[model samples]
Target: MSFRSAVMAEKEESTVEMEETNTNSRAEDEELADGKEDGLEQEEVECANLEEGGGDGDEDEDDDDDDEDQIDNESKKKTDQDKGKKCVPGIVYLGHIPPRLRPKNLRIMLGAYGEIGRIFLQPEDHSVTRKKRKAGNNGKNFIEGWVEFRDKRVAKRVAASLHNTPMTNRKRSQFISDLWSLKYLHRFQWCHLSERLAYEQTVYHQRMRTEISQAKRETNFYLASVEKSQTLDRLRKKKQKKGEAVQDKSWDFTQRRTEDEMRLEKMKKKGLSKKNLQKAQEKSKAIQEKAQSNVSLLAKIFSSGRSKD
Candidate 1:
């Protein structure tokens, strides 16, 4: 009985210790789960705060962009106003452009004096260009040019100072020996040159159209004449084949007397009446008949004398 009681007590003590250990382990698991939930919640809050901060930062960036745009617009307006106050551009005419001297080189040389606006270089004639191309000369040649300067006084000064002077002082320059033939055009604008060029092109086109029209008319007239002649020839050939006489439809009109001959005739008839002019013509005819009859009778007499001999 004593042995059985002791075994029962040991079994009881082991079961209680196991139960206490399971309870402690269960509590620790619950506490860890609670801590994990709280950490997840805190993480969510931090993410929300970060997202809100990012949105605010984006708004701030947008605001900065808007401010910059406004500042840029104000600066552009100020620049425009300043530009409106600037002087009108001046034009300079180049009578002759040296070979190998281009607009870029010209600008580089003249840019030291003042600001350049627009540049136009007149190309050589089409015929000259064709000849050059045929000769394998690919270099472009400018006959004349016009340059716009920002200031009128600067343009005038540049023109005056550069005219009759060497293009450049450098010894190795290609245009070193060439002189500038610049002339500042007073009251001239780029629009004027464009208008002039437009007018010239219009006139050239008009002239070419006129010439072409005239040539076409001449060709049409020549073709018509040739066709008429060919038709006449065919008609003549058909008439000949039919053994018919080709009738001459041409008329011989009486020739009119000149003014001098008419005047002489009028003078001769001035004092003569109709009856008198008729009697004079009759007398001249009778004298011509008598002279002819006398010559015939003398001829007959001479023939008779020759026979008697």
Candidate 2:
């Protein structure tokens, strides 16, 4: 090959390699710029995370205030009760669980730290569309309640010991899945319920707050008794309207029918009327008289029988 041709080929090869080098250098510059931008984005994200964490810390501070208040009230209640005074301790209300906390499970888990005395679970009964069925639906029936160890100090210990442990269980929903449900009751003191009756009475305490409205809060028996009284009033009104009432509301017999009519009316609607109530009164009177007569008779018979023997 000629020397001039070899020189030309060499120049062409060098130029092509220079172009490739330039292209690769440009690509590397772009990659470095991209990495810097990604780092800036990540830094911004980290800053935002810090801000969020700061806000959560504020919320935690607010929660601490509520807990402090609860503990104060419970302490005061115990003091009053210890004085042997008619200690009607004011109840402290705990707001909804922060995230995942079952009051019952938390109470039990916290119980390890203190003695739980009496736990009362009262699910509110919300009014339903069906007047009767609605009347039957109690919220307390849904939200459970419990009494923990009688020792309040232990309860506080459990609260401190179990502090941040995840207390979630299968029953907990996904929304609160991350937060622990088992925590201590801040001001809950332990009290033991003796006998079934006492336990039932204790149910009035530690009820759920479903019907938050003040007017709707009521006990089962209180509401049931009110319903019964209402029914009786309606029945009385019905009898009055029909002119078949046995006695006047004021019990003024002189203004109504004779005693014979009252007896006949009672017979006609024996089941509907309070026949047993009246019959029971009369039966009790008769029984007392008979018992007195029997006592006298027995005494006489004893004397005579002994004489005869």
Candidate 3:
């Protein structure tokens, strides 16, 4: 009985030791799960703080950029205002403008760049004679002009940009094919154009004088031609009269006549001879008078025309 009781007690002690080790293992597992949950909460808090700080920094950078842009715009405006206050009047000349290009269109074009002041264009010539036109003597038809701008700097800029460049129109259908053929006169001044125009006027008057003198010279030659043709007609008529006289003489010789008839014939011939001499003298006087009148008429016409000119 004693030996059995001792064996039973040893078995009870071994079971108690196993239960204590299991309880200790359960406590360690609970502690590890609690630590993991606390670590997750701390990480979420740090992430939220970092996001708030990043948003503030981004807003600050955007504001700085906008401030810089505004400053630049203000500086540009100031410079443009200064340029307007100090600019002077300026002029430019064009050498070869197209016949169809009008002043209004040019004004509209140039006004886009700057303000305009004055414009001048060469007038078209309308003095071509019908004979020359019929003989296909068509001359060159081009125009030249000058334009004054409101500001000298603007004028210089426009001249530099448009010089040696072809002009094109996009909005108007009529000018679609009419590219402007113009040459900007970079070296000429407005005063030079005025001087050249005055010179041209004087030259034009001199040309008119030369034309008047030439017309006077041709007048006498034209009259001489008319007189020469008139003389030829007179000679022809005289030859016909002589031939008729010869025919009459032949008839007179063939016919027989008495002495009384012959004496009567002689008397008639003397009377006809005196009449012919008088007619000849009158005709010569009339020719002299006509010649003298023509000279006076030509002189009067030329002198009157020159005086009017």
Per-residue CA lDDT of model 2 for 1-309, tens digit only, reads 699999999999999999999999999999999999999999999999988799888889999999999999999999988886543222122223442344665566545545455555433434432454566732232243444554444444554554455544556545334433344445443343135436665664434344443446556668989999999889888988999855645654557687656765666676545676567557767887897788778889899999999
lDDT of 3 by residue, 40-111 (tens): 999999889878799887899999999999999999999999987985667777776765567887898889
Candidate lDDT scores, in order, read 0.91, 0.60, 0.77
Tens digit per residue, CA lDDT, model 1, 1-309: 999999999999999999999999999999999999999999999999988788888889999999999999999999999998787789999998889888999899889989999999999888898999999998889999999999898999999988888878999989888988999999998989999999989998999999999999999999999999999999999999999999868988999897555645775778877687677667767887898788878989999999999
| Runs in model 3 lying further than 4 Å from the true structure | 1-88, 127-142, 164-173, 176-187, 228-309
lDDT of 2 at 290: 95
Q: Which stretches of candidate 2 lie above 4 Å from their native place?
A: 1-115, 128-147, 161-165, 169-309
Report model 1's TM-score to 2 decimal places: 0.56
Off by over 4 Å in 1: 1-85, 135-138, 247-259, 265-309
The 10 consecutive residues of candidate 3 with the worst lDDT sum are 244-253
Question: TM-score winner among the candidates?
Answer: 1
Best by lDDT: 1
